[model samples]
Target: MESKSSPCRPQDLGKFEVTQRDGAARLGKFFTKHGVLNTPALLPVVNPNILTVEPRSLWDEFGFRALITNSYVIWKNEILRERATKEGIHELLDFPGVIMTDSGTFQSYVYGDVEVSVEEIVKFQATIGVDIGTMLDVFGRPDMTRKEIEDAVRITAERATKSLQVADTKIMLNGPIQGGLHQDLRAKSAKMMAESEYQQSNFSIHPIGGIVPLMESQRYHDLSEIILSSSSELPANRPMHIFGCGHPMLFPMCIALGADLFDSAAYALFAKDGRLLSEEGTYRIESMVEWPTQSSHISPYTPAQVRAMSKPERTSLLARHNLEVTQRELARCREAVRNGSIWGMAERRSHSSPHLREAFLGIIRERTDPNEPSAKRIRSIIRSTDPIRPSSEPLSEDLLHRPHIIHANSLLVQRWRPPGSWHDGSIGAPSRVVVMKGGEPPWRASYGSTVQRVLKEDPRTVVMIDSLIGLVPYSLEDLSPWCRVEGSNIHPIGTKDADYSVDLESMGLGGIPVLVLTPEGSEYEQDKSILAWIDRCSFVDKLSVLCAVSPAIGCEITDEIRVRRSNTNRPVNVYNGEMHLFSPRLNDGGISLALHGAKLIHEAMKSARDNDEGSTITTTK
Candidate 1:
């Protein structure tokens, strides 16, 4: 007998994947039946009652792949409700891209009640064939009592299974997380919605709801806390939407904290008031002599000319300008993510608003404590990233809190063992750690011979390179990203005496004596003389950082090492006595190993951890 067909799944309707990331912020692609939408993306809120700009223009002219409209607005109007159900949302709006519908949650918050039942809106959205639909979540306002907020969260969560059951298989559903201003409730709500699976139905997106009031009050600190709390519990693969956030000024910070989707009516609302959105902040046309922000919509005419136009004309012009600013800021954020510099961009943008700056500082100053739920959330973000990066650039004091750098430092403390062996078979006490100073990368050139000479004098000495963050062992001169800053004369690359002991203390090497010097004062030595030591020690460092193995065990894997020298007489490849086991990257100095060598590291990982002095740094904040 022939088998029956398989039932539809969430992936059958839509799929989401992370393409690139920095900290918690990521670039994602949402695949749907209509087309792929790249995020972090904005969906301009469309009101059925009015069309300020044609929906077709949003697709062809403005280049947006998705938009959001209120299904309740359509459901309330008999003409719109019938037309949408008959013709579908796309035809009614006259757009070809992905469209998402809301289920009157905000309307309920505003009007205190809605005529439709909870399941009615979900079924209607399915009937109209919206690519994505939001459930009828009860909006949890900031001023509500704790009991009220709890009820909101419980009710919203309870409605998820019914909403998912009613939504069409072709319609990807959004399950909103509602909890007012309480972070615990926010996390609780996210956990419930993300796991709201019932048969062939589950939410495709989780939007942090009840945040419009916070945004309205400029409660950016609370906004950030809400994001961190929900993001910590939300699935990494699914996207997180910052409900009602569209101001360009807040884009960098919101993206940095892990918002993948956003929707706002601010562009039209602000435009009606004659205010223009910009990367820095909003600008009022009446207060402007000229266009402070140059966009194609406003570039042709002077500010005075725009102000002189009729109200309807000016509002339309300003709305287009606001959209221009919004799109430009998102592009800038995507570029920053590629550069591994989104935090720096967030830093620069934060100063434009006092409240935003405070929020940014709160993230920068957060501490990792097991007792603090917020701290645990920050830890999840940092620990989730791969410390090895694809690009290099100049760094500053700003990178001290970089998640990548923190992860590497934590590994250095937890997995790395000090260099010093009495013989090839036994470990010895580390007497002195020679730190190379006033030298920049290519550290192999500036301090290579000096390190060799120091090792020649005291073979038990551990060689280290100084950086703006701290002192890292010479094995990581290039591999530990903090030491990979570009340009020889940059301040962040060179070592400073003030940071020496503190760094040593953190690494649990405080008892060892440190002697700081540069190649300029030292006698040169042949490069080949120390390649064996460099290869063996570098192997241990790489294993510690990347493979999470203790240096003691990593040493066992590299015991039978045979080195291949580059044209510059530097170690290029490592042979485990006979088998080719390791190859070091020329560009970044990171290690690449043969599959056989990977097996060895994998076997040794059972005991991977720090010694008495070694411990995992609270990898974030």
Candidate 2:
């Protein structure tokens, strides 16, 4: 059945806008001729030859905004080609939302070359009204040699311009990045596609192509490297598609790494193989007595009953179940992104499979590279200091190098008010740094006497409470995560057991002598050695928590900043210099700068000018 109303064709197709972001993950909208695709979204693969589940059901029932089909396959089939050309691909597929079409690249990789020319295939997809059409580029296989892969990249780059030219203004063309398993070649492919002359207007999406083999072999580390290497170089405005990556298990990690679109036939293929998809891994249907998950399609029937049904009937049911699982996982990922816990989700999912864990570690290592393209994007997304959220599990060492954490730490060192003389007041740096260990608020009550004694001995002493997440100062005791996060093992600061000297230095406390203060059952007396150490240590006060939350903007404020309590006396607004930064108390909510407050902070950071006439003190909800 044809769509009753024609789809809205946007004037500027492929224009992507980031509506929400958490770390490197973005909740965005990619406009297309068919409709706006809210991402990170899954495009279920629809094979024209076989219908496991109707595309309409995917839109109406499952709420899928988009689906992908093979244009080369439709073109090769005479009857299907005639119907597609006459009625448009969307009508033939019976899908009203966005429809993205592939350009035989995967087919050529699998079947050893397709018959259609690059230009011909792109033109066919555009003529058939495909919202997003992929260019017929060479798919570099992981097994190929470096020289062979280089050649593949070169050929793909050569074909990109002509394919995009054929696609023209009528449809948005996908510029697929191909470099097999070679990191350098992947970067090269990304650069070529992003900078190609054809990219001026036509290219809408950047799909990292030819990694299906790596995924199939469970070489997830290599896959992670390829994605990071390629995405780093691509244009930031365009949505990135992880070609042939459809499993629900891989979605969170890929999305965290900045993948916006995913297409795969895993739903149907796994269904045919009687495998069930879950966030953890695929489970074999025959081996399970009970359903692994709750799905409307499979919950009503027993496994034995499902097995007894005809092949088509069973495949359809399982296919629906697989799609349901895929959709549910994507929803979960989107929620995590909105909540600023995409990294936590990715970390949790990594433990589901050893390969995924290896891949996660590999990504962490690659992020350390200064030249990594994803680094800038990651830093941009993680500008807010509160992205490291409290999870059911304790914050692990893995968070030490998380792009967001690093960004937060950097900002803290740069912006937070150190204990020193300032334009607004003279707080002065501490003579000694006290790292408070093992405590819960009211921290003032627990360590109030200790802090008083230390300050009395040396008025410049800085007392920092080392929480599970990071080091926080006595002034910001009521601040979240530091105050709200609960954990059993709060490691002692300055001990060889937990080495955070570099982190401390990064938070602008380098060269300061630290005295580790351990409270025994909520009370402790300082000995002579501790007193002597306090005399030797340099002073830096109220640096840790400010740096922890607003690493970039925290240190810059000389004005007295206090947390304004809500009706429940919960810390909500950070008031400083006629400005306030609102941070929701929930674990997932991020710190949002009120419009006027943003101007004040930006001006203080010297990142913006004070040209506006209005008072910068106005509040935002």
Candidate 3:
């Protein structure tokens, strides 16, 4: 008997997998029929009604792999509707990358009401062959009452059922969460959309909608709350889109909050308004003497020359420049995430505007609020910290419950390995805890002799580094935040006498004698007697800090670890226990382990287990 082909499925269409993470920031790849989208990515909103910069240029020039256009806008224009339907959206736009289509939700918000029906828009997008199609959900406005917003959410959900049924197996649908400014309503909407029966089969992305007004008003605090409220209820596997957000200024914070996608028409709109987009903020092109950023489109022409061009020519030039700036910032964000410094990037960007800074603080406060259920969810997502601030920076209220710092401290208490037991078969905690402080790196050069001497004299001592974030064992010295984080050297005011007794207790090191080594300067002069004492210690009593692992460590630990920093400095491959690793001292001041070294450590641990040397390490965060 002839068997029928398997029906089309969402997995067959594309898939999203997180390759690396820093706090809520995820470096992921979303596979699509067209190509792979490296997220968190921005999709420039292209209007078919106008062609400021060709869609093809967005791909070839700017390197945007995905874009979004309004389906309803095409549907309203007979000529565009006919061309789109007959030739397909890709052909119509002359773009070869992934294309997403929006139903008239935003249009409805702007024009009071759209003529298209929910099912009608969904089916139309499918007919045009969009990679992702949005539903015709009701746009909830911030000014709406609770009951009104509730009705909007309910109506959107109701529309979703029929829209999904119509969109089945044809295209990926966007299940947007909308509830205006009400947190509870937003949560309710998110939960419903995330758990909907159709979501399992058809939904490709979850976009938080109805917050454009807030962004326009610069009410970033409320915007932050809305995002947190909606994201807490979203499915972790699926990407979350921050609808109508294109400005580079918002990318760092939004990406830090787990938003995987952003769509904005700002590049063109701002260009039309003579506004130039920048990471700091938008500036009027007419008022600028020099180009804020060098771009092929605007760099050749002086600001005065650009201002003298015809309006259409000027708009096109500025639009290209704006897109270039947006792309650059996105690249910067991706690099930050790779370096485990997204939080730091967010902090730096927040200083661009008072409202943005307030929004960032608001997000921190809300996430740290014990009473908020969403806060708990946020805390769970933070996996690592890239030392949110340097020891020299003043600790603000926002630093207390910073998600990355919290995650780091938690891991320190939980995953960190403690020294092995004594020869008497009795568990022996370290006699004293040594905290290394003062300048960065050359730890081996500065304190190597000191550490060796202390260990040689008393093998039971535990060495820990007091980083800007928290205390981490010597074994994790090369790990993120501790090694790669950059910040001030000054400690926060009023924290000099702060009590860390509870922190000590959490790591099971409470009641132990503590010794702190503060270097007088960048260099530490070694004492020969101390080194000679270290040489006398037994090998079993001294802990071994293993050398580099394999290249897999570079892949797994730091996402896309780069060796080349500049023309002057190039990385040299070195071996750590028969494993190849790249030393990136010149590029970035950090050590990367290779896969073989990692396996060597694993095998050693396994051998210990077989020989019954000691019990496996266990921890509680």
Candidate 4:
């Protein structure tokens, strides 16, 4: 006889794998039929009964790639059950992305009983084309006795076999860790579940549930420790789902600690409570000074306007707002991961949740201090329980100490220490020439080609200073070739608030003779300040002002400074209004333009450094 076929073949089976893990923290991805999911992601919770936001809208408007709904709820409702069974959860929700199903454990905790069996719910989830399914688990509340918690864990593990037996599809199963608030019991549950044959064959996620109440009650330290212990034991390959972590505040720290998946109704819950999710935490509409965002989504109505509307209307709009914020935060997390800055993002987020930050600080301090005993206690506890099965390579110390990079709040003193280069020696003090150049310009449209060519050959630290209109900083390299291709049409690299005057001295752009490229007919104040800074440098050194002039807007160094330069300690090499013009980098990479690229970039560097110019400083407030 032919061997029985595995439900999940190597080709069809999808799962998450940790690429980089720092202690309990990790960076990973989840693969599904729909697409690969970037991990440390929050799966928005959906209620079929409520239908607050359509799943498709969640994907489109909020960028939610995955969402979770209750398989038990669908099974109990005949209409939903029939539709789900016939077409699948994706068809029912009209969502093309991954759809996960909860197994009714939370509802049972709330209502005291549930109608469906564990096997029945798993079957329903599989039949509904769910991407992932949860095995019905007995939830032991935070106040439960140790015996009660142990009993719950045992029962859940016992039922795991039956649930897997009935799950006919390859839908991933969630094996929830239940131990109420007892750390040892939690570890015991994790160990017992991992040891079960059903666990080895079917479970794909180890979610720590029954802790929503704990988190809701502000038992955060308990929640933190529980998560640390429970997650530490689970197989690193499988994603760790936080069953009810919906609030944005918990995302960074949780993701940092190897929690790959999360689901929550916080957006809707907070919306109903008249609270908006902000980076700083939830806020009431009535207390706001100004609008948090300027997009059409929130710009349609001000917070005061929304506050005056009927409660239902206000709630719906606020729910949308909260969801948008949640999605944006998740996007930020993903971007940080891509740029190798996940820890940095987490550190910044810690500031918003002081308690969470305190919890982390406590962990770091305890681990770092020689006198702390928690290390021994923690090691003993984990070793004794041995929840996570020992894998080939254990988490390493080097991984744990990885630096957390964050945006500098003030003028950041980032040491330019690249492997072995300009970052090394203390060169002579800064020159006094300051250059003011137009950014996001007519030059970009008309002369973008030239900019790219110049940048390709330019050795100067080509800093693309911002006028403080956006939230983040950017570099000319980021805008490069793309800006040249799209020219004058290039959108601002950052939003409007990212404005910061070019502080040449601080930026290492100071006191070398300078080239100021101003766009003709542009009067942006920061651009003018750059020119003024250049004038200051002229007092001590030479200042060169280069303009990218359009025929329509005549290009001229309309003003010049004469040589009664200042006696600042810095060298004064200034080329006062020594103007030059260049076209944009050409679309086609021809020899002539390439030659021009080398020449212009070289001349700019020479003029900026050759003269003993005065120091120049530009400020944007």
Candidate 5:
């Protein structure tokens, strides 16, 4: 027999890498012998006999890196079990990517009982050469009391000890969280699983199981609490799976709260009823006026084709569409995580289903209320409250340093209801602000130089460049408020000089002096090009000006200066006076650049206004 640990083996599978941790929610990559499974991913449930979509075909079409199947189903059938054992589960499924197997807990729930022993199932799964396997935990029914739940947990933990004794394949074990509705029981179960040496080098994932009833009942509060209590107690490194939760509507909340993998038989389940999954919501096959796709089951098929097609073919094709939809939602979620907008995506997805939205709101309500000692006791007694949402707050202030804020989606400016004094006036027109971080010169240091040049030369500019992107033209009609606020790094608009063609006049700031607030650099020339450009613009000379004075230098262009230096034609004024650059130490999360920029611009404007130069301030767009 080949050694599992032997290096240079052609058969060895690899591992997972933690990329970003946002509170309990993590973004990671799980490396398999075939390909990397991106974390916070959904693994669609596959039944071998059912063959909703062929596993290999799923990988080819959808880029689904991993999937979960039932070992018990395959094990019970002689032909299926024999073939899987002899040729390996991967070969049986014909899937090269990672495969996970369930120990028939869910089947047991549906069928009243399952006769398989814990050790027998684990050994069967390992021998099949499965990448990950589940231990047969004693699942708790919804009717189980605290004592009964405790017994189930204790028994499951005990079974884990005996099950792994015969297991040798470094095949990952799913140490499922199984404490029914009891929060303390859930926590205790998780802690026990975390400590037991039985779990020492064995388990790959720890999924929260037996919650299908809770989800179906919309008992979101209980579901949330169970996950929170269990996940917090488990080891940080291992992936956490939310068993049987494949609905696109539920992913944002679950993913936000730190779940890594999810599985659902929803595509098959929904397809059986002639329903199609979509980001907006599920659409019924009968009610569709138009197919979401150009060709759907409802169309391109003659009544003859529909009547002639076998039930299995129709079901399989519908199941394929539903699975495709599920994969699309998962892809959107992964992108949202990469862009640091998972919560926002969740907010939108909540609207997909009313029940889903209720569950989310329940979670949000529980999350907002500060926990009191009495409330904790009440929580223990009711067992009905929403899960305390894991904090969505960035892990640290420094981590909150997001790069840029482009309109990745529509909700950008509308959703950015600023905290504290950053509020807009009551019924204020929408505004955009481009916020960047750091203190170095825009040229030598960041993209500040490029931005400064754009704002300086453009007429009717309302560019307020600072730690926050805050640009307010007289109106908000032309540009998306979100688009105005440039996110952290300003990538050059591909091949298009957007800076020149942006048409500031149409944006309602045609005559306003552009606000080119930036962090003062160590040297005078840090912003010299911008200043020189502004000085030379024919249109700028006609506009009134005010700069928030920065200690660095220069007042807003003044009238006394306009008459005296009119003949000089310096086109650029080099304010050689010493100026302080915005540099908060690396450890501090403060935006020294933004603070200093705002102050300097504000002071310059103040100085200009004090000198009695008339500046028009109009509100009507």
Candidate 6:
């Protein structure tokens, strides 16, 4: 099942809201009764029975805001059980931040089964006042038969009623999605578990359960399959915990797929086994002449010195190192979300391992939008990306797939309409296209005069700029993006002709007779009539795309056009006669409507409504 971040809502215990996003990956807050916790975060798995790193240090020194422990473990221990119930789990663990209790489900996966039942553990976790709790789910093993996996999923869902019934409302509960290796069953489990069976409440968070063995084997491709298949089915409002997925290498892709919370014992376990974690891959201390990835915990000591230490000392050093690596990588993922560069980070991180690369590419090849339902909303990165970034990046092979670029191109196809006379020429379309190559922005210097001449002569001729981004009409050129590109590294237009052609068709541009023409090096021709025509065309196009007004009506609404240009000779504010109609913001290449323009658009829309009893249309042709 999928989980997403939302920033618009006020959060409380059992409430999750996404504050920011890049693709499906969200930088969000999960409000626990204990406190508000930020994500894409890692919850260091703490064993109540064993303290490799103290829980308080995990919060203070390691900088983790949340940690998970097994309720079953504490429940089995008579002394610890009595202490936890009396003192509360926070007092028992000596931690002040959020504490999440796990059901014996994972222990069930490890040992044959846990002695505790679902009802007892739920009541126990609630009575102990833990902030978050999990139901004992049947861990669907990769080796399980189809019927067995289905039954396991059913058993887990069936337990939700009792689980939520027994759980205290003050604590959030994890509804685990299970299907072993089968993608379909995973989706089914996700949908069934999205809504809590208990009245007046819903599951606070969802964990993708029963895939630890896949992570153990580095079966990342299958792990990605489960995430991609199940994510869309999960509720976008809750955090999706990738249960037991703790390795740093998997964090980038998993977070990118909308897995919000993760808990893993690998940091401690790997340390004891003399292995160190990195975003790339694990390293064995015995083989390391130098630390491939250094941390404060291990940088001062040589591998030989570390190996020479006492067993307990060595374990502590390595565990701290592994913990720091995990913390840094998770922070890196959050920063990527903030910068709208998570896909790029994931791209770079994918090269860390062959399996990771396969998983990244596999998702790329997935034509379906895995971040569905969420992506369909107005705040989805696809609709809300900034038109101009502060700095430009060298384009990658997956440039078209980037969220901002995808958003830009999608808006064009969905909103842009060629002018009425675009097909008014002799060829049943425009006579000449004049496909100007946009090398860098401030487009006026090279193409402005040529565009003016082309439109002056034919009036109906199509003028388009072939940019690093796909097809863009002259009206929208220098608007954004292209203005902010790094010319030195960006691929020249027409180099990726096939990809360009697909996007061009997506824009539904008509077949023009003649294309690509260079600028004529001549003195500027100041023709007033042609200049006004150009202004009208620009106004109509921007209005249609930015405000979703009909170009024909926009032309009707405006009889006068005056453009305010920036120092770069790019249009900033556009006026209709004496009144400001629209402004293409220089700070970002998005259009803002003037009050008068909004009134005009409103009038057009209200007039267009056909449901009113007295509404009628008048023909002008």
Q: What TM-score does each of the candidates earn?
A: 0.90, 0.83, 0.76, 0.58, 0.60, 0.87
Of the two candidates 1 and 6, the one with more favorable lDDT, higher being better, is 1
**Model 1 lDDT tens row, 546-593:** 777666667677776777887976678888877777788876667888
Q: Decide which is better by TM-score, 1 or 2.
A: 1
Tell me, by lDDT, which candidate is best: 1
lDDT by residue for model 4 over 1-621, one digit each (tens)?
A: 211112333564667766755434567767776666767778888888887778888877766778999988888899998998998888898887778889889999888789887777787788788988888999989888888888898999899778777764467777898887776677777776666555457576788888899778656666666776676467767788888987777777676555778889988888788878876677777787678653356777877788788988888788888888777777666565554445546666666766776765654443333432333333432223211111111122222333321112111223221111111122333332222234553233333333333333342223243322221112221221222222222343433332234444454444455444333443332332333332332211111211221111110121233222246322122233442222222221101122433354455445545652212211110
TM-score (C-alpha, index-matched) for candidate 1: 0.90
Q: What does the lDDT come to for candidate 2?
A: 0.73
User: Backbone clash tally for model 6?
Assistant: 7
Taking the tens digit of each residue's C-alpha lDDT, what string does model 2 give over 322-440?
A: 99999999999999988777887888899999999998887766645676654443454456435345443346667565555566445545645444532222355545677887665
Q: CA lDDT of each candidate?
A: 0.80, 0.73, 0.72, 0.57, 0.57, 0.76
* Minimal lDDT window, size 10, model 1: 612-621
Candidate 1: pairs in clash: none
How would you encode candidate 3's per-residue C-alpha lDDT over 230-301 as one tens digit per residue?
987887788999999889999998898888999999999999988889899988977789977677778788
**Tens digits of per-residue lDDT for model 5 on 47-149?**
9998878887777876777889999999999999999989998889887778899998898888967889888898888899877788898888778888888
Q: Which 10-residue window of candidate 4 scores lowest in summed lDDT?
A: 415-424
- Model 2: per-residue Cα lDDT at residue 92: 99
Best by TM-score: 1
- Say what the RMSD of model 4 is: 17.0
